[model samples]
Target: MIIKTPRLKKGGAKNVYLENVSHAVTRPAMESRRVQMYLLMLLADTAVLLGSFVLAGGVYRDQWPNEFAMAMGWAFLPIFLVIAVYQRCYSIRALDEVRYAIGQAGIALVLSAMLCTVMIFYAKAATEFSRVMLSLALVAAFAGMALVRVVMHLVLRRIYGPSVSSVLVVMDGGPKVDIRGAQIVHAEDFDISGVQSSPNSLDRIGRLMRGMDRVVVSCAVDQRTKWANVMRGAGVRGEVVSTALQELGAIALEREGGQSFLVVSTGPLALHARIFKRGMDLAITVPAVLVLSPLLLLVALLIKLEDGGPVFFVQQRMGANNCLFDMLKFRSMRVEKLDSKGARSTSRDDDRITRIGRFIRKTSIDELPQLLNVLRSEMSIVGPRPHALGSLAGEKLFWEVDADYWQRHALKPGLTGLAQVRGYRGATETENHLKDRLEADLEYIRNWSILRDIKIIFATARVLVHPNAY
Candidate 1:
């Protein structure tokens, strides 16, 4: 027998996918300049604020800023900058619109004035500072900031062509859609960076996204999942035109040529929002664990006393990005060498469930240990529920049942989720059950807010008594 080995192509499949596109535009220089622009804008805004303070002092007291007045005005600088950052005023996206800049500046002005009032009251300095001058300063701050922004915007427009955002448009099968500031790039063009998706047509759009402002995905409804997963992984600002986005309500609708399309942008959570969400998680989870310590101890004792087995169960569960982490639960089933994949879905009145397990599972008290997981950052307080690797619906694995199943893992797994609150919890037997759960998860991801998370948490309390949980 003659031994023969095939020679491997150089650069591998990735290089092959990337080789077609030669004119790959990278945005590092533009991005660096944009940062410089943000800094320059901040400096200009500071000058306007100081000028407003001086004007207010002169108007109110017939003098330029005194030492105390200057001190007060300078003190407002850090506060103003903090509020501006929290409001994302310096963000490139914020600069995209004049209204956005004015709104953010107004908010910062109001907040700064409110903080000044509170500080003066608390420090017993209200009698020292001129209230009328302070009021004028507040008004002037807003007016001055807005004026500065308008001037800077006009100047920048003249200098740099308005900094209009560009997007890469990827079309699957649809009438030619014209998007402003978008370049249509074929998936077959590999001279530019492209994402090789299917065997027939590679998803070259990924390669073209380097310096692009955003990506507009217009594909068949069935192919939405594929595009969504790709964009989610890319961590790029993207918008998908889908009828499903109409669920996001009137705000997401864009009308073109009397035709309405639901446009959903996959921008990452704002820094302040992310901080607020994480703060909420820590706020609730920390105190709940502390206050419920006795109850947790009681549950642990019950699990231990039932069959002299381990009180806590640690099992691997899929978390964000399909990463596995050891998830904790109060031991609710009979201690045995069971499959880790949760191959055997727990049905109502299952024999594997111990006496204590039956009670805990029904009330969802068994999930309380996951609060530690929340504290550890392995999970979130409100997100899609994680599942075991072997978790299945009927005879097939969960991912095998639906292509979009892994998308749920894009967010951290939670102790409870939108699916549970919507009555889609417990053993998923049919494909429809899984689909319902997936839909709820996707909806949660799309519409996540601090208020929505609070609502889900409140809704989960009602679901704890749900009869289907067991």
Candidate 2:
């Protein structure tokens, strides 16, 4: 994880010697300061919210405390916290920039206060709390929170030396990079490779990335995928330097020191967004399963009676992050003719399908068992549909159709997706057929929202018995 300067030999030749330099490069004392700062800012904002209302109460009514004012503060605190988190008020960027921190905090406070006032008015509790006191509290709270952030920013910069976040740049046979304030290490010096399988190599890489908030890798095009795999589980913001304008599945572009880098790995959704999506999934799936239990049982029984084979067909499909998972479905093919790899596309009047199998496939009853996958978190109620590993488009695999095909796996595969609702389902007969679905899938990922997901679920009802199902 450490590097030493190449020493010159007695004959005036440069001889490069690499050794463990852990003792030479000291680890930052505030390695976990990012989390600490987030907690500190949250607590500071809460304290300010309560304290401001208390102070306002004393000023407005000549009382040291007011019950209504305290209640208002408590109600407003949660709203403010939620808004602030969504606005990135306590993020690393906010921590480093005083103006950004203050602006986001102020906006969050304003929005929360407005929402609280509206709620109180609707609840008919406006008569209990004075408008003048509420206004005063809002003003005081905004000023207090902004002041706290400014002070925190200055303190963090002083304590952590200019940048609160640590960035590590690993150079591995790519262009030389000079990132200001970033610790640079030669990948060769440490014998690092994206395809490396040694435990010691992985451990050393982990040690090098211990205190980093972001790790950037500069490697050859062939090594990008390997490095990406390594960084996906590295527990940090990972980027790969590339000259190409677009890289497969890049989430964003980062420019540093007149050079561009592709942000290859990041959580697709923010924390709050992920919570909302998951909540929606559970809210719908749990009840759907309970309500349709009778129908599900009937179908399972029919399939079992039709064939003495397994009732459910479980095939390995690529899911989020290119990880494979067993995608469940009601077995819709004859037991002896089951194609586990899905190499052959189903055709109308396919002899492999039994009478019940054809009926279920045509009605999409075969897909109902995947609701269990949604419950297992291996799939979502709405996302890009996961494909069988051997599924093909015009004799080529799905991924082989386009490089960005893997990008669709950024989110959990869904029970029904935008592509399916738009009638892009069934056997992909050509490359263009796959491309059409791929475009819709990528579009869905790029503009994902709870509302859109709900719409897709509803639209799917209309396409459940499409002609392509055969």
- Taking the tens digit of each residue's C-alpha lDDT, what string does model 2 give over 342-408? 9999988799998998899999999999999989999999999988888899989988999889889
Q: Tens-digit lDDT track for model 1 on 52-73?
A: 7788888877877656667778
For candidate 1, give the lDDT of residue 420.
86
Q: What is the C-alpha RMSD of each candidate to the true structure, in Å?
A: 16.1, 14.3
Off by over 4 Å in 1: 1-122, 125-270, 337-339
- Report the C-alpha displacement of residue 210, candidate 1, in angstroms: 31
Instruction: State the C-alpha lDDT per candidate.
Output: 0.75, 0.82
TM-score of each: 0.51, 0.51
